[model samples]
Target chain A: MEADELLVLVAAGDQKAFEDLYGLVSGPVFGLVRRVVRDPAQSEEVAQEVLLELWRSAARYDPGRGTALAWVLTLAHRRAVDRVRSARAAGERELRMARRANGPAFDQVAEEVEAGLEREWVRRCLDRLTALQRQSVTLAYYDGYTYREVAERLSLPLGTVKTRMRDGLTRLRDCLGGVA
Target chain B: MTGFFRRGDLHSLAAPYALDALEPPEHKRFEKHLKRCDSCPAEVRALREDAVRLAWSTAAPAPAALRDRVLTAVRTTPQEPAPVRPEPLPRARPERSPSRGRRSPFAPFLIPLASTTAAAALVVAALFGVQASRAQDELAQERAQAREIAHVLAAPDARSTAGRDAEGQGIAVVASASRRAAVVTGSGLGTPAGERVHQLWLMRPEGKPRSLGLLAGDTPLVATGLGTNAISLAVTIEPAGGSPQPTTAPVVQLALKSVGFGE
Candidate 1:
């Protein structure tokens, strides 16, 4: 069933539909969360929270806003980023640990050559972006860094990071239009 | 369009907002703009669909156990009611004044209007007074709970340890040796089934475990009256109000000493 239809059932408190939706979206949600939170244990915790939230707030899902997958993944990403940001704010020790244990930085060429055909296509589309554009997009989206943090990391002006992200995502949208 | 957002600036935020890249304040402002703007919502929807492709690129199989956990949670957790669209408040019609251009024939009857108005005002005031007192009581209870957690966390002899369940769910215990009080904070444990709850137990070096308390919701379970001789902490699903002895296998367990308290 399409996610929208399943979500409609989910909104009506349909357990079967919710299970189907969970099966459909849990992998991407977990994977996206794992990329940001990094810790296996913490990632799972955050993923569970995100899914439970999806269940509780199913009625709040507006089909007109976006696709169910996009909605769920977006919620997952936000929660993961919130976890990382809160951990960083907890102490310098946490920030230092997170930095030391940080996942691989976004590397377009390396990623392209390493993945299967599907991911390879994504990587190639990402490669179409300029170095700065890709960096800005990757740091903010995948790394879960805010625009201010992205600016600081890349040593670019805040306005520049914002523009790069906007332009870069637009370019990516057009390039991945066929795939999406 | 105002100082909050320059002309066309909301358009640029569509991508970042879609990707969850904007900070909270900017995100809120852009969302408010989204409600009114003609073109930005479509732009955001398109951007989100594209962003989903990026998310899919990173898809790795979720842990095997997550499926059961999620399914169980869906089955057990109560679904929230669909939000009722609030009806806009009725605008007040202009009130006819007794001293207006044309006084109604009943004007004399409203001569005691001052007294009647005073009585209605007293009733409204009394209702508000009761509501305020009730709110204050709830606030006091919350404050007391916060103070208790703070006292436990701030104790000089406080020690803490954290570990994960088999499914990589986090559980942490913080206890003060002198006070014999502890708090168990767990993440990723679903709400227990009907008439059942996650129960915290303090296991002695030998013999059966003793119940600390039945955990409620996701809040940290603050348990007191602990014996210093208890060697470890464990959690299990048990009948509501708890059991003298655990009826089910422990979902997670951790040694108290591992949290760094010296004997």
Candidate 2:
């Protein structure tokens, strides 16, 4: 069944439909959260919360806006940002990054990143950026650095950094070529 | 330039929100704009799908134990019945329930349900319940037997299709060494078939497989799990009510994924 139909059933308390919905969307939900949370344990936690929310608020989906996948990705993105933006951001984020970046347990994630840098759509979009734009975008996003931090790290003027980040994202949106 | 907010500025600001790089104040401004902005939601979605792809660069082959843990958590947690949220259409009609049709004459008389028809109904319900309970016991026995057969045939290193079958199929597919066992079709699986339904049993050792359930649709779905090493599985062409044993040749044989074998 289509996601909208399945969601309708889920609202009606159909457990099987819920399970089926999970199978369909789990990959995207887990994949997106995994990148930002940067820790398998925390990523799993965030993914679970996102899914539970999806189940609870399934009635809120508006298909007129986008595909079911897009609606779900939006939810996943919001929740992931929340987890990373928690008050304990610095310590917890650093710890999580350290585990994934240095620990043997996260070898899989690191290796995937190294290999995936070539194939990811965002990465491809990044390629369309001017050199400084790419760096500005990366520092601000994947590394979770702010514009000021990105400027300091890149040794560029703050305005220049912000401009590059902005320009880079515009180019990315155009390159990916979606509803916008 | 509506209300002094230029299109160019809104367009530029939206990217930061999409990338999740916006600060709280900026994020709120965009959220407010998003309600009026047709393009921003789409941009965010495109950005998120891209975000997901970027996220995959950070794949962690899910831990082996993760599945078990997650499945357990999902299974055990009493999920609040998800409220059916239909796709938003402006003022869509309220959906009617299947039972919204004519009420049985018994319904009004039993408004408070004078405990009698409800009692007869309970008895009728109980009659089926008793049958279902008996079937469950039989299913348990069948599963145990299948486990035994699986044990006998399974190599010491075998990952006997025990919990996996039950877990995945939402039913117990346990087995034993006797080439006999029972299956408890999980409630997650479908309900019992109507009048005439399904019949199941062992169909290995070259003889006819034994009959397990009728229409096999009853709760726990009249399942009797079996191992290939123990016995072959085949559905029988029985009446909708099902027979005590195989009264006919096997009708449908289940090709288990190499049951009674090593993982």
lDDT values for all models = 0.62, 0.47
- lDDT string for model 2 (B1-263, tens) is 12344556656665456556666665556666655666555455445444433443343344445445555555545544423644222111122211111122221111221232322232234234644556666867656544443343342212122111222322233332233333333222243345544565643321234556553342333233443223234444556667776555433333222233100
The lDDT, on a scale of 0 to 1, for candidate 1 is 0.62
lDDT, candidate 1, B39-65, per-residue tens: 665456556656666776666567888
Q: Candidate 2, residues A1-180: lDDT per residue as tens digits?
A: 545567667666566887767765666567667765677688888887777766666666644433455567667766776677772465543433233321113233454432231223344455666877777665555555556555666788755776776677666544433112
The Cα error of candidate 1 at residue B144, in Å, is: 78
Clashing residue pairs in candidate 1 are none
Listed models, DockQ each = 0.17, 0.09
Off by over 4 Å in 2: A1-5, A87-125, A146-152, A155-162, A173-180, B1-11, B36-53, B56-61, B64-263
Report residue A1 deviation for candidate 2 (angstroms): 4.2
TM-score of 1: 0.54
Winner by TM-score: 1
Instruction: Report interface Cα RMSD per prediction.
Output: 20.6, 14.9
